[model samples]
Target: MTNTALTALREPAFPDAVITEAIRWTEQNGPLDDAQALRLAASRTADAHEGITQRALLLGERIGLQPELARARQWAPWVLLGLAALIVIAGLGLAGNVVGGGERHINVIVALASLLGLHALTLLMWLLGLLLPLGSVNTASLGWIWLSLTARVAGGKRGQAPVLVRAATGLLSRAKLLPWAFGLVSHGIWSLSFTVVLAAMLFALAFRSYTLSWETTILDPEFFVRAVQALGWAPAKLGFPVPDAATVMAATPATPGAAGQRTWALWLTGCIAVYGLLPRLLLVLLSAAVLRSRRKALQPEWQEPYYRKLAARFTALAPASIVDADPGRLRGAMPASLPASQLHDTLFVIGFELPPDMPWPPAGLPAEFAAHAQRIDGSAPARRALLDQLAQARPRTVMVVCHAVSSPDRGTERFLREVLMHCGECRLWLAGAPDAGATQRWLDWLRDTGLERITASDRPDIAP
Candidate 1:
């Protein structure tokens, strides 16, 4: 199957490519250590935002997400099939009850009511629900119920299945596809049931002898005649027989002539077909067509702030050989320092060219700094973006985290100097423990860059 269709069939919440990309992103950004993130970044698309959606399908299988999803896939179809079977059986029972199995006189009006009354009511309710917001129509549809049951059956209280299902539901709801998606299933069920009813009615009428009559104590004979004629008008236009005025006036609790009985049979079946089966069938086709046409729009919102940050991180994790320019090519006039009072009360922490081995955000840092923390590849674009943002915000404190094991370079000094100009106070964090001599060399290098106030520390507990 095509990957998009497979995702819709299996995951529902996200496409396969998106699900894998998200898993890769989580492994890298969260506490989980994933060496694959960097390796995958090397082969990623040139466009950072677009590249995040590229497939990493095996990641789920590698991380045990596939087994859980497989269980859900296995159970959903059977559950839906069982529900459909029950509906079909109910339709047969309804048809049998209406016809009285040729043992008693059939009340034509009562038969129509028994067969189509509940169907009409539910159909009207579904139509009315369409007037509300998107996704509100038929929230309790058999399809949604099947989804919930499948999630529970496969995922229970703790598994990736339910999580993925919920995500799919939320995504579909946001994309305004839930009503139509579920509507397809709901309408399909009703359509199938009505089809069964019509078939069973035709079968029973063919072999059995039953009288068709209408009896009412309070209403006049003309009322019954008008009702039968009015109800059968559309059916008659479709070539189904409708009784003449004399036939209607003569209907009693006794079997009529063979021709008259044939007319009644055609009228009853035609009315059911026109009113009950046809509407549900048309709705099924409409919902299916809508879902087919709009399926392409069923993608994750990559523009959201959370995904944006992940995109930036994906770019940052790219290898230096791919993104960085030669040190001699770096160009920009030194910026003037902003006043301390202009800075906001924000703690901005950035990892500057830290090696892949170092755990990001420096484990001991306070939780409040989470939002402001970022890691960059020290590429020109990354520098410009960071500088532009800092220029506007001018955070109160800026902390540049570096790998203590690596020696400082002129490019590092130049970037630090430019960054220092935008913040009120700056601190240097050497993320790993190196020898005292190496630490001294970094500290001395900071002084030579005309940054004496910036002290290098190995710990993350330093006050902002």
Candidate 2:
């Protein structure tokens, strides 16, 4: 078989023994038939595909890559842009009024009202994004809650129900998207409602100028007649009316044309204000309703005590105490009672007693315990036996100090997995140097096997 094929067969999904037998069978037969080769390739491919698919599924569920939530992310930007447009229009109106020369500049009340309306509209869009299920979006909706409830009910039942329920519950419980969705909808609704009310107030203010009017020069017929008479007289004497005369005529009382122009301007301004506020008002109201419904559906209850009890029970499985050891203390603190054989058993920690031959550190030892130690590779059968003995001597929780190996092999991962399987109910914490990439891969493997990595860090408190 090609190296690639050989590598594929070596994956954990395929039994090593089975691959070895197949290879041996092929080699001894020498020049297999086409059918035989095809069978071998197919078997390897099946194993590889299964492994990849299983890993992908576990990872996806862990990260809450639900269909609904994915859709939400896609449309979030568009909603934000709509909100921005409302603000831009309101700002332009305010700027235009501020810059234009008039007896009254832009009404501060109207400008403020328009701004409030825009804010309301923006709020509404945010709410819609949160509450309405975007089609095909991978959202962690009520599905997670149902799965968790089912798990609790079926946990101890016979057959596949318990297993299936537990699997579903774990996926839903760990996923973050559901909680995030709740928070977003809650906050968005509140914000949008406030904005909507503000927009309405602003719209009312923008219409105030149109609703209330006062007499002006433009509204006076006498000013119009006199102004026109002067213009007619001026055209004969000069090409343009004199500056002083023009100023006097311009200030003359309003005519029907001037009154009509003023009325139109007032009406247009009022329309602009109302039009700008309406969409935002609608959006805000829609968002508020969605938020209210979601809140009702997801009302929080009192469950703290129950969760605390569960946490306490889980932590009870850990061993009572462990000796604190760091990289420097490895060699001297090796436990003496450990047997040299069986170190290869994997997941065994050999703790050595401080030997007289070992050198002491410059600082004096503390009153709490005897000398410190280091971790040794327990993969060797002899070393594993020694470590196993020490583990048995102490309470299962006794921490062993060990020297950090320069290059711990991949077998360490196998050993950790074996330890977890053997202990079953016991929680395992592995302390080691910083190596985020390797740690993540090991953790992912553990997760796939229905186990969790309690902690993996280089901090002194966590160091073994």
Candidate 3:
């Protein structure tokens, strides 16, 4: 693969133009069958957009849509983090208030439940999801909303973009890359927010003191005891202390000692830290790993029906005749020596579709060169008639004139090839001032056609 094609698959910029260029190349290089060309073209445009080179409109790098998407969403991460921080701060405030003053007993049930119960419930649900598939449960998740939100605001809907960009924009359910990126970012914020919540909880505990006890209007002591015991089981295994059966039985709407309060606080915070903050942090890392793996797997697939049809259509064109002086290779082709014009009977100068504004037998034509040269249109019909004429006129040296400004297309390439076959001696002459971009395209066509040299004299006014 050329660097440009690899880039086309990688960056994903303006791809339509690149496909057009690849198609054109396949048309001219007939040895490369349509399927091969189409596969190359499809692979390049499958996921990325390609940019055009400024001067020659040649294929350039694949512009990455993700970077552009990120740039568009630059403020999103900080904004999401800010919102998460505020929510965590608010949750800490609500969870921190010790509901005891006169008796110095923080309602033990509320105190632990406020800090750890929701997180434990969430962890239980997560475990349940793993153990048993819950069909059609509409769990509330901020991740989904945030991922789609990033897609919408990131120009994921740019006009006529490839499947990947469309997926990033959420037009397809199977967008592989964009969602991963959003997931990585969103999970990171969730992890950070949970960490801050844990920090706030610990900070509050440091400055304040409250005793722990539980009060129940309906439930028996056994029910509360079993609930606390079950919630503490996992943390207990990791060495956190659980209140004893005696403490549970004696627990009432009354204050306890500072040591008791500290134990209860540590047990609650330990559960939240282990089951909530830590698990969310792990999810953040997992999402990041998934995103990285997906990035490595990013590649263009060419097996679709759409690409197959294009390949068939392109291969259907009849190929033109070509000659092979077959040079050693692309680099530094050795130009063959053109014998002097005086050695030929007739020096025919053929004008190949020169623009009306540009005069024929353009100025700066050497007196020795122009005197023996005669002009003729370089079109197919004109060449066909000229072939019969040439069969009889039998010009010894036919110098075909083409502007250095115009890119070499099939018509001109075939004309020169046919003329070279029929004439005793022939050479392609590029007429006009040299421009690097046009000259390069022209020379590439010449090399492909097995014709490698251009004459010295050129008329400089034409542009293609």
* Candidate number with greatest TM-score: 1
lDDT of 2 by residue, 176-205 (tens): 223333333323333344344345434544
For all candidates, the clash counts are: 1, 53, 10
lDDT string for model 1 (220-255, tens) is: 989888888999999888898888877777776643
Q: Is candidate 1 or candidate 3 better by TM-score?
A: 1
Which residue segments of model 2 deviate by more than 4 Å?
A: 1-65, 68-464
Write the candidate numbers in order of decreasing lDDT.
Answer: 1, 3, 2
User: What lDDT tens digits, residue by residue, belong to model 3 across residues 187-214?
Assistant: 4555665677777767767776656677
Task: Name the 10 consecutive residues with the lowest summed lDDT in model 2.
Answer: 1-10
- The true-versus-predicted C-alpha distance at residue 296 of model 1, in Å, is 0.8
CA lDDT, every model vs. true structure:
0.69, 0.33, 0.50
TM-score of each: 0.63, 0.21, 0.47
- Which pairs clash inside model 1? 13-168
